[model samples]
Target: MNSSDGGTATPAASGAPRSGPRASYPAEQSAGSRRRWFVGLSVLVVVVGVALAWLGYTKFATPDVAGEATAYEILNPSTVSVQLTVTRKDPSEPAVCVVRGRSKDGDETGRREILIPGGTQTQIGMRTEVTTSKPPVIGEVFGCTMNVPPYLTQPAT
Candidate 1:
């Protein structure tokens, strides 16, 4: 049979495939795909960066000395004595201690302040002879503001 009459086909081309609408992708589509991929990669990188930043800030950020305070009472008062202990996280700073007392009438009876070096505990002890003929109810409140330096806040090895 003749070739023009649909005889057995022979190999036509050589090194590369033929170029056509179905064989090759459009230039615009290829460029758009690349841009979309780049945008997706950029978004992923930004998300990862933000997550890492949040973790770093939460973990390594300095302790915010916003304010830490606690109150407690000592029972069975004979000779009323107030004691305060302050410890500094850093060795360069100083610890502050204060002792105060309040009477049954809600009056400031006594107060004392002391300072101790950093990385050390300082205690302030005070003794006051209080007479409560009418069943005394002595109230004491300790208030302090502390700022821990950065050097002493190193993470444990």
Candidate 2:
């Protein structure tokens, strides 16, 4: 059958099967599929950005060292020594370090308190001798503490 405008009737009116891609599906359904794909892509991009930010924070969020242990010497049965390289990020920040020694049995044999004056240099190397109760087989640094200890003092003029 033909319509009043002289065009062939659609499958619904003529009762014949439709042909071609657009005729197979409705326009609203195709638009809905496109919207779903766009939403899925947007979610994937946000998840990837969050994951990258977390990785960056975990890799770079720790404090840096104030001082580092450079070397040590087990001089004699009664004495041990350690060499430390101190760093002062702030010129007024004093440095106090605890140097320790260990015996052959892996027991602590000695510990010494060291003080380095601040406002002089960014990095300084110092050596201090430690008294030991027994012969120390090795010497190591426990860690360095910022600022001066209570017992340190300067002589009065």
Worst 10 residues of 2 by lDDT: 1-10
TM-score of each: 0.31, 0.55
lDDT of 2 by residue, 131-152 (tens): 8898988777787767466776
TM-score of model 1 vs. true structure: 0.31
Number of the top TM-score candidate = 2
How far residue 26's Cα lies from its native spot in candidate 2, in Å, is 33
- Alpha carbon deviation, residue 104, candidate 2 (Å): 1.2
Query: Can you tell me which runs of candidate 1 are displaced by over 4 Å?
Result: 1-79, 120-141, 145-157
* Candidate 1 residue lDDT tens string, 33-130: 89999999999999999999999999887632111213334344422443333333453554444445566777665554433344432333333333
Error of 2 at 62 (Å): 5.6
Q: Please identify model 2 stretches exceeding 4 Å from their true place.
A: 1-65, 153-157
lDDT of 2: 0.74
Task: Say which candidate scores most in lDDT.
Answer: 2
lDDT of each: 0.46, 0.74
